[model samples]
Target chain A: MVDQVHKEFRRRDLLYSGALWLLSLIIPDPQLHYRREYRFRKRDLFYLLTILLLPLIWSDPHFHHIMVLGGIHGILALGLTLFLGYAGQISLGQAAFFGIGAYTTAVLTTRYGLPSFLAFWASALTAFLFAYLIGRPILKLKGYFLALATLGFGEIFLVMVRESPRLTGGVIGIFDIPFFSFAGFIFDTYLKQYYLIWGVLMGLVLFSKNLIRSKMGRAFLAVAASEDGASAVGIDVSRIKLGVFVIGAAFAGLAGSLFASVMSTANPETFSLNLSVLIVMMVILGGMGNLYGPIAGAIFLTYLIDELSRYQEYSLPIYGVILILLLIFFPDGIGTRLRIRLIYLISYWGRKRRREKVEL
Target chain B: MFLSVEEIVKHYDGVMALNRISLQVRKGTVKGLMGPNGAGKSTLFHLISGMERPDSGKIFFKKRDITGLQTYEISRLGVGRTFQTLQIFGNMTVVENVLTGMHSRIRGGFLSSGLYLPQIKKSEEIAIKEAKEILELLGLFGRWKWFASQLSYGEQRRLEIARGLAAKPDLLLLDEPAAGLTYPEAKQLAQTLSRLKEAGLTLFLIEHHMGMVMEIADEVAVLNNGELLAEGPPDMVKKDPGVIEAYAPRR
Candidate 1:
């Protein structure tokens, strides 16, 4: 086993390129039939390469830490992107699921001595179970009612945590949680953790991208377009809504578990409405329905928060003003404006060439 | 009896929208449902498509009792519907609109699709192939990548039918398909409906355009005052005094 490990651990680019080749191999080639849909394939590949190579250039431990944290938030935001952006549903209870994940890992690892890997999965499962239970009831409500119900559920989770002092550690929170490990390799350093989190994040983004282009993904968009229209096409709108909601919860759980392992703590205060609101804002600011947008939003907002901390007390007000400005300027999404502009430019070029041909 | 609605009654806020309306659409025929404004044409469509429950009635498609089934369930049972107001997914491109309409035909769910399983990839290829074919039939295949919102009104209406066809439903219920079409466009639409009828699909459509309905429908059912006023071959119904009275009303 040691020989096998050493043999495969030769070089980074070789492994990374091998991974990319495998990804390319699995990227089902219906692009010929969907020329327009696959228009951004080259750009996507570029992004993937950049994500893989980004750590080498930015080796600052602090930079890695911030990016690792951003990646975690990015995963959480990606989960909500599928639910809220594609399916056009509202959820304010994402923090509750995140909290569930953290607490699940914290309790299992601390008291029962469960391994981080198993506890991590266990956290996701627990959150999925909870979302399944609550989603059916809450997803029935649409619009602001759904939002309010989710908000209430988040509040209830906080209350439950505070009330269960023995289990949750209540106000003081749980500490000294072990770092994440799998098959004996510990993610103890910020650089290692950075790769780990971003790796997970990129996988999820790929999964989400694959999903949105598939039938079920289209059903989500249809539901967002019009419930009656979705039904007209044989899509079960409510069921799709519930499906995305649970998936989002599971994502939050995964994020939460990672948070616990990295921070080495779990607390009730961390999974509050503010976090939930922040995730929603990330989705909004990044752009809904576009997978990369929310993750970008998460990373940008994380860095923004870090940068603004220099202002001390004035950071929050400035943050609020900046967010409002972003929303106003990029209503569709941060990337949407750029994409639209690119389209306009391309069309303008096409028109100019056509006129030249006509003149000739 | 490929599709049947027996004594379907519906009302809204003390108004008798459809008073015990019973209708049947035979296989491979274009059945036109015509009525004056507020004569319950759309209300009956809502009930048949399972968008709304009838106060009392039974609806059956392919011998399955679908009276109170949810809209998607009824749709899965091979009933596709289009709304009086356009219900196109405007955000999606033309081919995507049709692909979404093929939801019932797709068996892949979140797990299979999100992971892009090999089977899902194969099935999706076939589905997209079929979607393009449907668009080809509507002459919108050339603009398959254009957003639904970018299509002109006539083209959008045809795109709606293209989406309906993508579902490959046995019986399609189109509500007010020709509501806002120009005369030439309506003529083209009538030809398209006639072509669809020849393709062995059942159609029960609601339309206000008398000429198009008369030209394409194998039979016409006229509704007036929440009651069946006339039912016969198009020429016979067109000549019926009761139908003429209800439509013109001596006004």
Candidate 2:
């Protein structure tokens, strides 16, 4: 009897999903309705409120430090999503851009005695220049060839940083990097640093949200969908690719500059092929092509890594298995899957309530 | 002539795809290209649109030499084209696909766009308004927000043309726009094409449906084995011996 009841329930669930799918097809959900009417979404408001209240609720310095790291990773992933996700290009050397930024900040602030504020912008400029120089040639490649080419670039950056001790401190890394300060106020406390990183992140998020809906964003989507079609529509495919690459590099650079100051170090080990792969993994896991997906992925992975530390050496294997499972189930990304599930749940309840009313 | 191709030649490996093909498109007229398989109709379109540079030839649009220009450069010169295969951005909504075609017409810097400056917002509003109009013209206004991939095959073809038209091109190149359309859809497409011609838009298309081509095309050019066989009014081309022989099925 119990088995039969379970089967009936399963059948009802399948029927509900099928009806929902069909309904979705007939009257397509106009996702922009809210954006057109209301400037802010409920989810956006929720995230803002949570971010605003997090400091008061989470007073632990260790948690604050980890969250700061998550914010940095969020920046890196956000930049990379523009290149790897939006432009539909493969990049395995984004960490090189990150390294370039960190080193630029490190060298300028330590050697030239530049202020952190000036060094931050300089780091972005240096990374942009580096991306532009290499992007012209590298961006021409597609698929695995592009991935390999970027990986090679990252390896070259690693070797150069390690070999140049006088400039980059030779793996021991640059130290005593001054904290980020603005107009005589120093971000000396953990709370200050947390706000500092999150503030930058929020600004970038807002900027990216606006960009993804703009004309250039449309061009990026066109290129990503079909290069031939994009060119046919008067969008310079190569130029767009190069532009996204440079922009992604600039973002990485900004994050790296903040990272150098926050962590008070610039080391070759921090920006490695492993870290590059980790960033890519974060993008894949968090979801590609959405603004918040990569950020969520970064935080999730950061927390996961921290929690898995108790597993000692076995943590790596466990983490790999979990990633494989995540990809299998939510290949589109956790954010998209969750969004779809939420819609389905709401529609299912609506249908059930309507059926109950009809029966009455 | 609004557009002219002079002795265009294109080769792939050891095979010649287009052999010294030259054609002219008069302003505000519908010109149809009819050809057998491997007759290089699509190849000629690609060359004209700058998808690939012809091995040798000169193409002029509005009397400007556009032979060596890039595809986007050619497009910016008021040339819009739809591919033989559907090139719709499947993930994007139908309206967004059309809006993307209006890329060159709207001007806003990266910073301005990212910050959603007032000028950028105005441009975006205009873009949406224009896109909706184009979609309505294509009979896709109701489905503007639908994903391009989810549209029916006929709608997808119409969406491609809608996207091409959204660019406000002086010369539009359509490759096999009615290949998968139902009879009614093809008729609708023909009507749309006629309306576009009446609106003073020049159309150059490649098609296999002779009935639709003969009915809609002001002039038709027939190609056989990568060579232009005949060019004349659709009625005269229909009676041409070479054109019939090229299209006739082999037993």
Candidate 3:
């Protein structure tokens, strides 16, 4: 009976994967179609269509740039999700690490005349080390204390970026950043940049997923649930907290570096305290604890921002109203509610099928 | 002796919590540590489990000094413990909680776990099988998928015990296992502890229930006002004047 059940679960999982694959092929690009249904998963077919159509959408000129921006935001959101959602540590220092990555890439490429790809990774590593050092002391503080400390860190980083004249190019920001490339193929065009960023984002997502399912992920969950309980159960709560913090920051760094290269500049304004808040908002609006929550949140928010930008003066207020509504009605976030609804539907269908089998 | 503590003292904010307490546990024996509320039984458990360091004194497991080891290190040293307040992972399923208990036994690291390596898969399979057997033993087989928070108080307590046992420890420290149990539940727990004892596992438990302690404890140690008051067989400790006086209601 156990074997049969296990086999059935595996079969269902495969079906789910196949359905996802098929669905990825059919959705229209968001840049081409500004419909309300395109903004969120309004229908069962919508998610399927989006997945199926992602590749074709990336091939468009304007959609390609939007995809790059989406990919960068997705990576940043994933990082925040790990720290805020899984590990239960709220940090607003993500923009600081993002700044670090952008600046490192900028300095390496413009000043040092190094390869952009090497600079990108170096920037990420630098951010990871910075996070490891800073996170040790900050992670000891709980909740709002850590949040405030991280906010301070972000502010300090922004100020330094603005003040540093020679290295950071001061408030004017660094320009003439070399484009991302592989084996001498420069990703200068929107299409090339889109594919490059999308590939990296997918890799980050897969890596993050695998990490979430690992022992480290379990330790993070334990720490998140209850520190005292985790300690009692022989988990090194502090170490696990620090590990997730650094890793999350590294993702932010990678996103920042990619953003710098894609935009061909590194500016203090780009990594502001507002960006940190937005990242945190994205994580929460997605669903803090769910893995896919941030992804959905990032994509949704990106499109919302894109659409709202046209309304210029009303954008901020519109965003505020939307967030308030989401929090009030869907406290678990869109991703979690959708998941719950899916499970309910599946179980309902299963029950009906079982009854029909009995009748037959 | 599998574990020993000598002249351990603990203080909290200048107040004595455990004053020069000492104890010994032989291999494969169920020893009882009994005391009134605030008698420092829990503090002693905390000190031994590496939750906190004793102000003065030494702790050893298998003749190796472990005075200042971390909790995870202590756990890795084959000393597993359950919490007084029931620290079972509430969000996880019963089997997942048990698998967490068997974390030390699983050898692969994050990479192996992420990649789902053969070793990790093998270990995971073994862990699931062992967890099932443990649940069956504890009469919780049917509730494997249930969240631990949904279980009855007695079942949760039993699940905590089962989690501790899943570690396959040389010594198990159970803190107030009978604190919230009903009469039948306490009786069942006593039977389970006795079975564990017969299976050659050493146990050090704190209990407020005298009936359960007296029924199952082969040896008993008494603490009063953060100091050891008496130590002997269960009957002898029960009859000790200090033990009775410490627990008795005051006029």
TM-score for candidate 2, residues paired by index: 0.92
Structural RMSD, model 3: 7.4
TM-score for all models, in order of appearance: 0.90, 0.92, 0.87
Better of 1 and 2 by TM-score: 2
Q: Rank the candidate models, highest DockQ first.
A: 2, 1, 3
Considering only chain B, what TM-score does candidate 1 achieve? 0.97
Instruction: For candidate 3, write residues B1-251 as lDDT tens digits.
Output: 68999999899998899888778998888789988889899999999999899999999999999899988888878888888887877756678777767776766665465455677657767878999999998889999978777899989988988888887888999999988888888888899889988999999999888888888788899998898999999989888888888889566
Error of 2 at B67 (Å): 0.5
TM-score of chain A of each: 0.85, 0.87, 0.81
Candidate 1 chain A, run of 10 with poorest lDDT: A27-36
Report the lDDT tens digits of candidate 1 across residue range A133-213: 999888889899999999999999999999999999998889999999999999999988988898888778777777888
Off by over 4 Å in 3: A1-49, A55-60, A339-360, B249-251
What does candidate 1's lDDT look like per residue over B1-114, in tens digits? Answer: 889889888889999998888878889999999989989988888888888898998988888899879999988888988888899988788999999999988768888887
Candidate 2 chain A lDDT trough over 10 residues, lowest sum = A28-37
User: In order, how many clashes per candidate?
Assistant: 0, 0, 11
DockQ of 2: 0.65
Cα lDDT computed for each candidate against the true fold: 0.86, 0.87, 0.80
Residue A256 displacement (Å), model 3: 1.3
Taking all chains together, the TM-score of candidate 1 against the true structure is 0.90
Preferred candidate (TM-score higher): 1 or 3: 1
